[model samples]
Target chain A: MIRVDENPEDPQTVNELIEILSIQLNEPVMKSTARLMIIISLALNKKLTFTDLLEITSLGKGSLSNHLDKLKEGGLINIKTVFSGMGPRVLIEITREGMLAYENYSKILKKLLSH
Target chain B: MKETPMDLSDHLKKVGKEVVRLDFYLLKRAFGVYYATWAAAIFTLTILSYISGITEQSDTYLTLYGLLDIGVIIVAVDYTRIVFRKAHMLSRLESDLQMSKSFKTIGNNVNIGILIVLIVMFAIIGTNIFPGDLNSLLTFIILWIVDLYVYMVTRISFGKVQPEVILAVGTFGFSNTASCLEFLLTGNSVYSFPLWLVTVIGWSISSLYSFYKAGEIHSTEIGESGSRFS
Candidate 1:
């Protein structure tokens, strides 16, 4: 039976982990967990309603709208309003850029966890 | 700048936990809408059947029922489309994350369960095995089981007890269960159409309550993690 250690104390391994962490920490959008979550959700869902995002994030409307605007400005997401019998609803879709970002983050996180 | 590898690992784990929490929260809410829609369909059908039988106006009931059936179908199809689209999006992801697999599994199982239950319920009704008009009682029993099953699934999957869902559905189920027990005790036509109608309305109200509770979560900012931007 093999026992798994929590954090390998090898100097090189630690340095490598630290370097990966540092690189990710330098990214502005990746600095915040909230933004990362939004991207992950949008990436996985492609598109979701504003209310659906609100429910997912558990954030206030104003704050969520602000995050959406930032994502839109970053070319990570697009926000649109469509009208139906139930009235107009906002739809948030992840852009190709956003999906790429999500993929990168997920890869980094998985690598970090493995170490 | 002085963070150790262990510290960074903890941070990454925290973020991952928060993301998973939010995803599960969204899923639970979606299930609420699903349950409400199904309850509405069942309630509407029950009411239509009762009205047609009482009024003896087959023509008007047929027209109204046909239109309502169409409406229900449209709504259900719309929900199916949304769910499928989301699943497709997840499938398109390059990395085979464990979280994604869990999400897809839950989605597939829930939907498949719905189809199976619908088909079985329809089959039972079509058979008309009961001697008298006790078939309606079977429908109520099935609905009660649905409520209990939902409660069980939510508890098992999310690891949190949704008391409101259980409470609302429980009240209706309790009343109907009592009705069934009473009928069983005395071999009589006590399970009348009016009683079934009342139980159907109760179930509908319970569904509305579930919808209200589910929708209520998003209206306000919850927890510090939710308000990180603010």
Candidate 2:
């Protein structure tokens, strides 16, 4: 929702910004803010319970499952069922590929903001 | 398939806030349990040591103080283990390096503390470096120094000086150090500023505060229940 009306005076800087945006947009999971928020939480915490993720993203169960499926299909995360006294619980953890992707996104964002 | 309406910079800023929030939540839970444990240990053990001293049971008093030192070190190492397991479970969080170093630092500190305590115990029991009259005072000073060192290392590990820690350090540090100084100068123990009272009051307050903080943290919802980030 934030609008950046003032482009950088330097042509090269504008080009760099456009390139960063394009790169982010091309990534299927990275392009969505919801998935990025989930990734950020996972990347920082390593593993989180399904309830933890639910509280974090505030997404509905079905919608959250869809996002998780996309993230799983992209090989960015792994989901495993854990049985406890309460019952079966889903635990999600970020993969190495997911971590790298998060790092790349972070670096690109930092680079863009610096301009 | 759905594009974010926000720009890249906005996305980063928003996600960054969530990251910090999650990090704080996990640490708060871990340290809440830690503070509560220490509160119980200090309150009970200090009272026992005080009783042993008043009963003229010199051996029991010394043993209790030694146990307190060892017990505290065990707690410190246990906390490190908890954090280590959390880090290992997460696999590759950005804070892993700092946590690994904290484990080593806490390990080295515990070893050094134990070595010092053992040497002091040997000198007290076997050698004449410390007179019989000074046995209790010496133990107090040693325990004070050990507590202070542990507090410093804990502060470094946690990256912030929590209120529970400050309360403990202030209470034990002042009471023990002042008692030793008063005994050294006046040749008599300060009955009015007894360690048992100080510990009971200090740890009671600390435990209450820590439990309250923990309760507050658990009550706060991390995010709105139905609002989607997208």
Candidate 3:
């Protein structure tokens, strides 16, 4: 049998092992459906509105609004109100915190994909 | 072959339904912006007119202002009705987001254009490009152009009734700037160029703050998936 070392300090083996561990740690949080929805929506456009989210996800108004509220509260989105001909409209955009979360999540996903 | 034709029809029907839904959502989102802007414009104009002595309680000026006020109110109420009628079909937050983004983009472009023209008008007046009477006439012409441009752009961009909301707010700023400058140049009023400069500085600072805030918000929503907050 080929010689094998069980020591965690084995450089090549340790690196691989650490990478595997990282993937496991990152996957569940980043890969969650709610996170995915937000990520996909923002990725497709630099901004998303409530109605746009509904169109993209085909989710009901209340459900989508709840998700948006959670995202906003989580510091994952920013909403602004502007006047139009019809009424006061809310514009939803992503925030730096949201971007960081997505980035970290993506790194985890990448690690998972690579392994 | 029979199955293929039927499947295509079903797909088309689904698409048709989706389009209708999207249209409704867009209308409501647009309406929200309209009402807010209208209210803001009226409030700002009333205050500015009072401060500038334009509201001297003259019959003509008062009548003119009253008519303008009534017009905006009518527009706002009518647009609100239209939006509410279609609101039920919207049933989606994302749709509103998309419409809002489009409106913001259009608004930014229009705002930039208005600022540029105002700057040009100021430069021309300062340099005596035309006599006083002609200058006033030219100013009116520019105002009309600005109004027309804002109306056309908002209507085209929103694809519904024209929302004069943004135009109203912008017009307030433009008028304020012009009136203040005119007062400084002609009346040598207490309000100096420095004050005007300060106003510009204030605008620039606030604008930057808003932009930074928007960037921060955008990044958070995107969450590293290269997503954009709408």
Error of 1 at B208 (Å): 5.8
lDDT of 1 by residue, B96-188 (tens): 334344544564566457657856985787698875546766765676766555554455444456655565466557656766765676643
User: DockQ (C-alpha) of model 1?
Assistant: 0.25
Per candidate, chain B TM-score?
Answer: 0.55, 0.52, 0.31
TM-score versus the correct structure, for each prediction = 0.56, 0.52, 0.32
Give fnat for candidates 1, 2 and onward, in order. 0.34, 0.33, 0.00
Q: For all the models shown, what interface RMSD does each have? A: 5.4, 6.8, 17.0
Which candidate's DockQ is highest? 1
Model 1 residue runs over 4 Å out of place are A1-30, A43-78, A84-87, A94-115, B1-8, B19-39, B73-145, B171-193, B196-226
The local distance difference test score of each candidate is: 0.59, 0.60, 0.46
Report the C-alpha displacement of residue A18, candidate 3, in angstroms.
26
**Pairs in clash, predicted candidate 1:** none
lDDT of 3 by residue, B105-216 (tens): 5554555576578668766866877876676656556655644544444454345542233434354456556654665468533223333343334333433443453344
User: How does residue B220 of candidate 3 score in lDDT?
Assistant: 46
lDDT, residue B85, model 1: 47
lDDT of 3 by residue, A1-115 (tens): 1112433553333224323423422323212344445543453243666656665455667766776776776667787887789887777776776655544433332222222
